[model samples]
Target: MDSQKKFWRSLWQLRVPNKIKHFMWKACNDALPTKENLHRRHVMDSTTCDLCREHLEDTIHALWLCKDISCVWSSLEWFHQAILVQPANFRELLARFRPCQDEYKVEIFVIAAWCVWNRRNALHFNRVVSLVTSICREAVFRASNVAGVGVIFRDNRGDPIGAMSMPVPFGQSMVEMEALACQRAVQFALEIGLTRVVVIEAFLNGSGQLASFENILGDIRFQAACFQHVEFNYISCACNSVADALAKKASSALVLQEWLEDLPDDIAPLVFREVH
Candidate 1:
């Protein structure tokens, strides 16, 4: 009981976003909407995981043990230590990190778990599975501030055709930065003489009621009309590593960067991973 209390205390003290803390709380309490919980409530007919279909979908299995989600954890350097001890539940899995001195690793674990849950939901609903590298990149993105924008243009074969990265002014919200990125991507597409374009965004959920977000999205829509055919698809950050990497690169770059068919050394690996 004291350990449980200690867990709660440490959880609230962590520096992660409140939404992540709330998610951790739900996970610890088994209050998450996992298929097992949904089955108990008659909300879902099967407790089997939709992603793996090999085991019952509980908080632990969904977040940690699922084969599909396990790669996200395995790809992390610190996760090797955490994975040594088999956790019986989500709370136990988190508890392993609680005593660790490095708070950043704790934050990564929490955020990655949350992202895995999100990916599970996305796959369940949309049938889109994000790559392991994208999930890892997203964990880093959430922990940092928005400093720039990145855009990558890919062919229907998922080969890179062009890319751009640019530093932007700080102090704007993430949604605003995402909006700016979308605008820049549209402009990039137009400048390259691409008529039919597809914009895959990791943000820009279109649910933001903020006036600034609405205005920027409106501008993007207006600019998109310039294309003969354009489609905007929303995927979670778990599928946007190449652009995320470029944005991270642009955050430190002094000037706008662009590329033709050849991608930079750093981004080429990401695109290759996505293509294969």
Candidate 2:
């Protein structure tokens, strides 16, 4: 009981956007109006999932446990690992990501879960079911965009270890830029001997002709193998302001700039906001 209380307090204090925090709180409470809840309220005659009618559409079945959701979560490396533990509820499922020790992981997980829920609603009302890949990818994009500005490095207790800011070289496509940032982050992690990492990026949605996403993905995979474990997540440009600023610096920089155990005056506040 004490641990659960601590978990809730920690969750509320996380630096995620308030909407995401609200969604997670509601999700844990079974208050998102899933079909099962609707049925209980006499608002829905059937409790079947709108996407796959094989089972009742409870919060778990809609976002985490449905057969249709299997493909979506299976495509994500983190969730794939979490399934082995078979969390009995959403909070347990989220706790699986604590090993990453990053609030960003929570952001990604919540965004993905919300995406699944949003898609289910669309199917229920619009009678349209888009590709699950598209939905998941969209979630990744949004998660990245919301985290405005700067690449932040932190310890388990959320203390800053280091930070890097570099601009994408001129004329590089967004895909190329994202791929480059991820590569550099991986290299930095390798240098620091950090075994577990999650690389977040925001690539233009299906944009850029210079390089195929498959090729970029191949490169990311190769670098990821150098770590004990690694994950790549996508977010929107809006969420990536700090990294974007760093990339801008790189663009104008005559050479690479590195900050160790300290941050520039301008970027320090962003880090402070994220932690406190």
Candidate 3:
């Protein structure tokens, strides 16, 4: 019981976005709307795994043990080797990974699990099947380093309003880069006279315990106060590809670059695909 409490504490303290942490909490608690739980509640007619259709779609099967989703985990050599045991439940499955001791590994594990759930939902609801490689790639990227920051503005219909990319200074940590990105995103929203804005970030510091990024986050909060409504959303890197590309573009660009409706030719295609 003590170890389980400690696990929950560590999970809540992770630097990943709040939504992912909440998703993990729901998964561990069997509170997620997996097919088995939904069927038990009379919400779903069938409890079979939508992706694999070979087993009950409990939180454990949907996220970790599903045959269709196995490739996503096995793609990462470390995860493949770490999860040799097939645990009975979601909590036991997470315990096999020992998420509390190593923060980096835990972050990757949580993100990957969230991606699995997201992919499952997409397939089950929207009939959109995403590649396992894409899921794995997104999880790794979100947990890995931050080279730069990218901000893009769009309207309700996904029309591009504006976008910007800025390079991060040397010696800054990943969380610091994410904070800088938030600060710049808010500043850009204000510049464009957007009274209501939604900031979509691939990574965010949910826990403000790190002193290094707290000031930056504070500035973000302060600047965000300028707008009538400002909302922050956490999205997978796959959905955030344009911003990801812009951040990579920042490395070679001499100065901070901004674009209006006419984004650079390279990024325009990505946005096109994202919206359509």
What is the clash count for each candidate, in the order shown?
A: 0, 18, 0
TM-score of 2: 0.52
Residue 175 in candidate 2, Cα distance off native in Å: 11
lDDT (0 to 1) per candidate: 0.82, 0.67, 0.78
Q: Which parts of model 3 have CA positions greater than 4 angstroms off?
A: 99-103, 127-129, 147-276
Task: Give one digit per residue, the lDDT tens place, for model 1 in 46-140.
Answer: 89988888999999998898887777888766787788878899888888888775536687788888888887887778866656555764564
Better of 1 and 2 by TM-score: 1
Which digits, one per residue and each the tens of the lDDT, describe model 3 over residues 196-239?
Answer: 99898854634554576667778888999998888988876657
Clashing pairs in 3: none
What's the TM-score of every candidate structure? 0.55, 0.52, 0.52
Estimate the Cα RMSD of every predicted model relative to the unseen true structure: 7.4, 14.7, 12.4
Lowest summed-lDDT stretch of 10 residues in model 3?
168-177
- For lDDT, candidate 1 versus 3, the one ahead is 1
